[model samples]
Target: MVAVAAALALGTNAGAQLYSTPAEVTANPLVKGFTVSGLTLSQGQTRVTLDLAGGRLVGLLVQGQGAQEVARGLVLAWGGEEKNVADLARSLGAEEVKAQARTAQGFAEDSEGTVLRLKVTGSGNAERWSAYTSLLIHPDSAFPTTANAEGNSKAPNVLRVFSDFQCPYCKRMWDTAHRTWAAQPNVYRVVHYHFPLEQHENAEPAAIASECAAAQGKFWPYADQLFSRVEDWVPQPNPTAKFVEYARALKLNVGTFQKCLTSAAPRTAVRAQYAAGLKVDVRGTPSVYLNGVQMQDYSDAEEAALIRTVTAASPSAAQVIEARLKALR
Candidate 1:
């Protein structure tokens, strides 16, 4: 992918562009040549690299030193309510350049997890400004993985999916995509995270109920039931009793399941997972990631091919970054 490099973090939140699939970086016509790098976590000093049109090169996510050191491109996180950038010195790296640029236009997004973008059209000293390159960085996402999953735990391919119980698309993926994928022998393991949206009234309860099912080692089937029969419980103001009935139907210890569902444990677990989703910048339900990289949203045929090729024999994110860094040397 051609890297969409920004020279500096510019402008107020005019109209923050929220990036879902990395494909948007190139597909976008408004911002010329903006793109995301594939490598999620870069090992050594050199993590990410960007090549601009004018032979201007920069690192994206560099870490480490010496024998295996690599250079990463420079990037910054803009616009958050907290307005706090943790680990700025360590994560931003040694080579980060600070400069102000003229922002012609800009983007604004949600206060919690937002992707801010700014457009720069230089008119004055063009030669001096062309040298600096900047890339927007995603908040450090150490994905919170749960015991709920399918397939081999050690498989090379890993699909981390975030979903809400009341989400129809999540049901679509569960019935069509993940149900098929998870059944495959060695393809990939699916790790699920609960992301209960505020808009959905029963979503939080359903998430907690699913966690309760997880306690009894019935998360998958219980989840299937939730999606399969969303109409039954979601309409109700409080689905706690209905959730217990599902536990009974699944032949789980109905007593323990009831206790867990009502207790603080399941609620705490649900909130933690939701916060984790926010950390990874998950804005919508059914957010899926393959091998730590965002799978492109494309046509059914193209997406099928992408799913096959990327998961075929691709290295882990760390391994991929290391191999590329060494190649650069």
Candidate 2:
């Protein structure tokens, strides 16, 4: 976390409230299988997991001690669910920790906060469910973007993105998906989260700046400026002053913004958002969740394809949007 404040900011959702609780999610006739997230599991650590059919969720679970292993696990899990841990790790064409080859329990939740405890009791030919370690339960509210995550509020389709300010790929997603679908306020909503990558030296500070900008209702504008000029502040040893300049340029209250910077609040908020991203298995920056089904790719092509697929498969309006979001959430 940055000592002062995060450097970059995100947006305000201009879209509709759409589905939050489970009742709002109806079955998606076109989609087969489902991913039930917020299923709390422990590996000496607690993590929110997506429950897939056939005990496949166990395969996607990551093992080991380091953050790098966790990240690698997420990348592999993004490939798709596997029958067991072995398949999950090796099938992705990268070898990591092998599954513990043991029985385990997990849990899932519904809209009303009902908890469903599950277990991977058997193994190999007799395997009932493929699991690595412990299982637990959590609330449905654990998912979904924060209220500050901004975009079109009236739109039925809520697109949540976890992004890094310095990531070029993230910028591409903003240009292609955000600006495009966001243009249609009635149909699409956007919620943004910051996931500054570790390698991006200036990413955290940039996030802090954007967060401060948001405090004064200049989030989107400040974000735009930061994105447009990543090179200017990225290489600086300390972009703190440059970030304040962005505030000044945007006519934000420099005094309050500066004060906000000196406090740890903005940085804490930004890191909280980043932690939220990890809980949902965000493997990479610019991870786009349109209506909560992560887009396979962040390009305009995937965006169009996802929109078309979701639109066609969904019943009248974007009701399926809620279903998908609920499933992923």
Candidate 3:
């Protein structure tokens, strides 16, 4: 088995601090009557140890930390058939059994339980079959902030966005919020993270370029230009030149921007952000989170409503807008 250790740093809607450590389990200790079987020599298994309560898996237990329970939810993995998996979830108190698309992941929920399931198919008939399940006690806890994020760092309300520069939907969301909520730094803080889909060839390069621009304190504007003019450089043979052009237009030091682009720093930073997205179970581009709660429909209006809800007791909208406008200058 490939053994690797990493730390997962997380912050909540209430600004509570949390972190994750590598966890593993060789036995089915938490779930009673659950048996471990269907093992193949080649296809090994890795299970994250978790704590259960009231017929539902509640929190995870890391080595150094005492029972790091999830206030929102938990991700669980099970190896079995569809009916067996559903039955097990039901036994654990999951109510609705909504079967999603055959190839897509599925989810079922109850009053205080939500479970995300992904059916795993092994190589040929010689491999073992399994299903990975995420049992969310609090669904909102699944969304976390990126490490090197931008925007109002100290703002209580965090708008964590996982985006690809070349995604049309992402661009639409960005355009919708650019002038309103994103501009209002006092109402909500926007945190940017990279989720470059493999289909978008230029997306990763653009993400790296934006990180390089961030090194010069111009990530927001550079990202704006990237999304606004995606078609311009996306089809180019060497988009690095176009990135440089954008940097020059932004009045950034051309030499530094160019150097940062080719260097390992920007690439490493983008990779880390991508890893962070994966760790939080991001399925696609433009995955948005308002204060650690995943946004179902990513629209400017929806984002505004969430922000208002979080900061309801704070300053009025007009006052917040005025402060945001002043901060811009």
After superposing candidate 2, which stretches have Cα over 4 Å from the reference? 1-140, 144-147, 300-329
Candidate 3: list runs displaced more than 4 Å. 1-151, 300-329
Among these predictions, the greatest lDDT belongs to 1
Prediction 1 TM-score vs. true: 0.59
Query: Which of the predicted structures, 2 or 3, would earn the higher TM-score when compared with the native?
Result: 2
lDDT tens digits by residue: candidate 3, 1-329:
00000001111111110111112222333333333332211112323333322222222321111111111112222222222333333322322322221234422222111132322223334322232222222223444334445557677676778899999988988888645666677767777889899899999999999989999989888998998898999999789999999999999999989889889988887887788778665789888766554555656464445334533424432233334323322
Q: What would the per-residue lDDT of candidate 1 be over residues 227-252, giving only the tens digit for each residue?
A: 98999998997888888888889999
Using lDDT as the measure, name the better of candidate 1 and candidate 3: 1
Please give the lDDT score at residue 227 for candidate 1. 91
Q: How accurate is candidate 2 locally (lDDT)?
A: 0.52
